[model samples]
Target: MDLSYTERERAFRDELREWLAANPPGERPQGEEADYAWRRDWQRRLHEGGWAGVHWPVEYGGRGASLMETAIFFEELGRARAPLPANVLGLLLGGPTLMVWGTEEQKDRYLPPILSAQEIWCQGFSEPDAGSDLAALKTRARRDGDGWVVSGQKVWTSGAQFSKWCMLVARTDPDVPKHKGLTYFLMDMEQEAVQVRPLVQITGEADFNELFVEEARIPDENVIGGVGNGWKVALTTLMNERAGLGFFLQVRLRQLLDELVEQAAASGALDDPRVADRLGDLHVRTEILRLTAYRGLSAIEQYGQPGPEGSLVKWLWSDTNQMLTQLAADVVGPEALTAGRPWAYELLRARGNSIEGGTTEILKNIVAERVLGLPRAR
Candidate 1:
């Protein structure tokens, strides 16, 4: 497949770059809340500029652009070094899931706010015990008169403390197999029964949280697909999550490569053959990942779904991130050991790349058995 951009695509990219330059994010305050507010305002600006929901249908406040256009938007966002939109969960996961599996009423109610960044959204997938084993989540959503009474805990819920809504998964059938007994709901975060306690990371930041639900009410209309068909609905969301994660990994790796090149040259480390080889390896890995993402984008444009190839992209991204960060630390030496440096924080954060969204071990299992038709390890 020729991954060359057409003249029209190049023009589109230029237009996006110009718009971003005109409305760049001014110096944001250092606090998390301030940064979040800045991101939200930036998202609104994108909406007003008619560049917010490039992938959604035109009737739903989006440009109805192709998958390549969506890819272009992300690439441009990275180029600008802008903070991610505060409503990324809604834009990437919730919006696409609703578009595919949500009811018309649900779409009408949720899609517009997501495009405008009116509501920040979070994912309530991981529980205290269900981080890697997602199908084993224990959150329960019991039937109430006109709604469901959601009661359980979700851990490592990123951005839940600031979100207005959450895409939640809960157990609705105890007798069935783990994957078959679940339900998905759109939950209100401000309800009296919902509690969010911050989870502090090694970066000395509370970017994730543990969510406690005590008889939280989820209206019947808030269900995404159906009662017990949540596993299918969740797959839709997970597929989108995998794709978004891959995009982030590529952008981050590019940033790391740029930094590494600068550091190596400044430190005269480029003269070392090992350092040179590592840099070359990272460059090749990043290019391969970029080509894989483009392939996924092409598939989405043609077939309307990225399919199982997304798992390959996810695995490659996670593993490459972990590997590249290790190389960065090695090259930076004592600077990487320092606490406040970006590479140090990045090295610590890379530990989660193998664990977040889905673990590298789990992703490898998926690619081996499901994608490659290999025998199960167990």
Candidate 2:
């Protein structure tokens, strides 16, 4: 309930801010590969400075920061306009999930590379047919002599092209129920059976991909949390996916708002009372998003589970981003719709905000049934 940071938290924030100040993230370059290489180099710098994966345990080559400190890490990154380290999915989702359900060997093999950005990781949980409903996924893994062979397709897989490993969930026992039949595996991406094809977004970026896995081999040692227990392991990844990164994203939204305001002022849109009113409303909403993100972290720390703010923040963020971009289109007019412009790109990219991570409709159901104790929408 307290919004002020404790002395220790403040000290932690101060140290990070000083480090970030000394090591500023310079301007990001053009082109996808160049941008990714730049981020990878930045991640390497963070690792060398011991800033990457700050939330992971010290034994795992991290700073062993508390949940609040981890939130601060993300907030500071966004505040500094630092691109999230190249291995964000690994740090935020894969490493934490492995800590929960991976074997000692698995941890020993994967954790170090994840922190150092040596071996990039991607997720393969969402198939075209079974994105929202994980249990319904048709990706199948069958027993072989000493491993399992996976064969199926996964869509919306970001970073797949450059990844070395995939946190994959497949149906290992089709005879049983859908959810119970699943198994999680650390499938190697370099194998011949795996194919990665980029999916171009409205912004003309191919940050997402389609993965065609045809009999891809995962050694028996890579089965995480044991076969038929994938749903639980996947939930760990999903929970981590939703938690700390909201801080960074909410901060980024604030940055975009500031830019929009400056642009509006330059374009004389500030003179229009209607434009001013919308910008004011959006600024208030973005601030609310920031506060609710903190609330969610506190709720989880205190109650051992997320409060209403968990799903609420994600849902609100998606809608707020969409709304903010629409207002940009209005204030900036023709230039906003012009191709190759930043505002035009943001306007188009905001369309995916509602669908990515988790859909707004699905998040609403989660809040209603799980947080509000309401009946199922079904």
Candidate 3:
């Protein structure tokens, strides 16, 4: 596959780089509220500069960038150390899913707000009982007049507290099979029926939340694609989550590895053969992850769908990130373990990387069954 950027692509990159240099993000504020506000303001700047929603179609107030250009946008943003826009869930997951499955009016009403960060979004798919096996989710929704009433608990919903809307999937019919009975809805998070509580992590940061819904109201028009079509629509969101976010994540992994390398070199730890060997191995893996992600992008551009490399890249990234963070503990020594330090927090956060999105075990299953054409795992 031709991996080199063409002249037009290089121009696109140059244009983006120039814009970023001129409009670099300000220093992040101290508290979570302030930091989120900072990111939201940055998204506003991006929107004003016509840089938001680079992957969205032009008709939907996006740049209509090609897949490669979109990848470049995320990579550059990560390299610049810019925080992802506040409505990342909306821009990456909600907007794309709606574009595919939303009615015309839905797109008109929702797409612009997401691009401009006027509204934040969160996901409500993973329940207490259902993590990887999403179809087995027990969140229930029942018909109520012209809308639906939903009740369930969703865990690990990042940015739930700040979100105005949720990409919710609930079982609407228990009589049918689990997968077939589900429906996708954009549930309003501002209502009294919804409660969001912070789920504190080992790092003492509440980057995620638990969503408790008690008869939350969702209009019939809010149903995406249609009732009993939630699985397909949800798949759209899931695929976008895996494929679109990889660019930023892979670049962040590279940046972290670079920091570790600098730390190792500063301490003369790189002189040790074992240390040098491991460092070299991590560097190689980081590049491989970046390359595999590009290869997946190429496949999507050429074939209209992502290749198996999507799963492999995430698996590689999570393992490599965990390895990189562990190496930091060796190179940075005590400071890496001290509370509140960057490396220390990273070490703890890296622990969940393998389990989030899709666990390593689950990814292996997808690779084996879909990519390798092997038998399904029971």
RMSD of each: 1.8, 1.1, 1.1
Candidate 2 TM-score, C-alpha based:
0.98
lDDT of each: 0.85, 0.91, 0.92
Best by lDDT: 3
TM-score of each: 0.94, 0.98, 0.98
Model 3 C-alpha lDDT per residue in residues 122-237, reported as the tens digit of each score: 99999999999999999999999999999999999999999999999999999998999999999999999999999999789999999999989999999999999999999999
Per-residue lDDT for 1-378 in model 2, tens only? 578999989999999999999999998999889889989999999999999989999999999998999999999999998998888999999999999998999899999999999999999999999867777999999999999989999999999988999999999999998889999999999999999999998788899999999989998999999999999999999988877888888888898999999999999999899999999999999998888788878887898877777678988898899999989989888878987988888888888988998888888888789988998786
Off by over 4 Å in 3: none
Candidate 3 TM-score to native:
0.98
Worst 10 residues of 2 by lDDT: 305-314
> Tens digits of per-residue lDDT for model 1 on 65-96?
76787778787787678777888889889999
Q: List, in order, the clash count of every candidate structure.
A: 0, 0, 0
